[model samples]
Target chain A: MFLKILYHLFVFLALFGSLMVVVSKKAIYSALFLILTMLTIASLFVLMNAQLAAALQVIVYAGAIMVLFLFVIMLLNLGKQAPLSRRSRPVRWLGLLFGVGIGAQIIAVIYSGFIPPAETTAAASVTIDHVARLILTDYLYPFEMISVLLLVAVIGAVVLARRHLVQGVETVTETAEKAGK
Target chain B: MEYMIPGNLVVAVMIFAIGAIGIMWRRDAITIFMCIELMFNAANLGFITLAQSLGKPEGVAVFLFVITIAAAEAAVGLALFIKIFDDRENIEAEKLDLLKR
Candidate 1:
């Protein structure tokens, strides 16, 4: 019973955080809410016996990714702008209708009894060691590919950001020239 | 325990739907990107749940790969957003119509 209550609590928090992320006016607030949502989801992973995933979710998502988001939010300095725009009332209503419709469809599918009942014997729990071994053996190629992808991303980010710096310098020079003239 | 799998699945679906709606409704590029992350997280939840139910480590393995890709996506996407902001002075999605004829 306690576990069930805990599960329900995390679920509530996760859903609530996601809603806040969507509706918050400030980008900083949205980023903070996303961290809350990620942490709740990580706890849910723990309840599901995915401890490694739970840890990574906290470390990579709540830690690294969100920090990046916050950095960009600060870098962009969006506070001076008007509040985030809201869709027109009719569009907002249509979006709500679509969201509800998709949700109802999923709930219907869940209740259709199509999902096989859980096996009587609990499945062997996955451990970090087992996942590591599987990655080294069966999934080695994709693992290597992921490393390459990360390398590419690093280079791409550097190039893009550097280009912006150069452009800023050029614009500053142009304005200075105009002032001199 | 019998209801655990389906319950988790329902939560995942709700999260995905919420993310999808947010993506459609929000104007801020960063917010839209965060919404996309939410959708990815929902999918990751479903993957982990199904993997646990089936007693296989493969799903977790895939989850790791997905997480790696998500990191890369965040890096490149934020860089692109910075570039766009440098050009336009704002990150509003509706105002980014450079490609729209």
Candidate 2:
């Protein structure tokens, strides 16, 4: 009974936080609310017995990703004029209409009784050991691929950001040489 | 025995829809990025729930991959946004017409 109540609480918090992320005028507020939403979802993962995922969600999504977002927001220093400047009233209304349509369709599908309830007997206890074994054995190739992907992403980000700096430095040196001559 | 879908998945779908709508309704690049992250989180929740219900660890394992990819995407995406802002002085999606040429 307590678990069920907790589930409902987290679900409500997640939904509310996500709505705030969407509607908040300030990008900073949206980032903060996104963190809240992520944390609440992490809690839901715990409730579902996905302890590892819950921990990673907190560490990665709520912790690292949010910090990155905050850093970018500060670096950009987007003034008050930056939020929702491009979206007109009609675009917003149209988006809302489509959003509602899609939401209703999903809810209807859920209520249609097509999906099967979870079998209590099939709820295998997911210990960290079990997950580790599966990762090392059955998912070894994909696991290695993920590391490679991360490496590539790091290189790409650095190269992309640094290109402009390199050009700026070249321009400065060219002007300095011309002045010296 | 009548079977019903788990409520967790329903909530996940709702969050996904909200994120998608936010993407379309907002113009700030950072806000749109945040909405996209929200959608990723919703999908992660769905994966974990399905894993728990179906008695499989593969779902959780796949989630780790998803998280890793999301982190990479966030880094690259933010860097791109920073570059865009530097070049254009604004990160509004509609005003980003440089690619039209």
User: Retained native contacts per candidate, as fractions?
Assistant: 0.68, 0.73
Predicted candidate 2 versus true structure: per-residue lDDT over A42-136, tens digit per residue: 98887777789999999998999899999989898975745664557888888888888887898788678765667774455566787899999
Which candidate ranks first by DockQ, i.e. highest? 1
Inter-residue clash pairs, candidate 1:
none
Candidate 1 lDDT tens digits, B1-101: 55678988999999989998888788889999999999989989988887777778999999998998999999999998888787768888887665452
Off by over 4 Å in 1: A80-89, A163-181
Residues A91-134, model 1: lDDT tens digits:
86788789879988987987898766666436647889889999
Candidate 1 residue A154 C-alpha distance from true site, Å: 1.3
Chain B TM-score for all candidates, comma-separated:
0.95, 0.91
TM-score of each: 0.90, 0.89
Reference-based lDDT, residue B47, model 1: 87
lDDT of all predictions, in order shown?
A: 0.86, 0.83
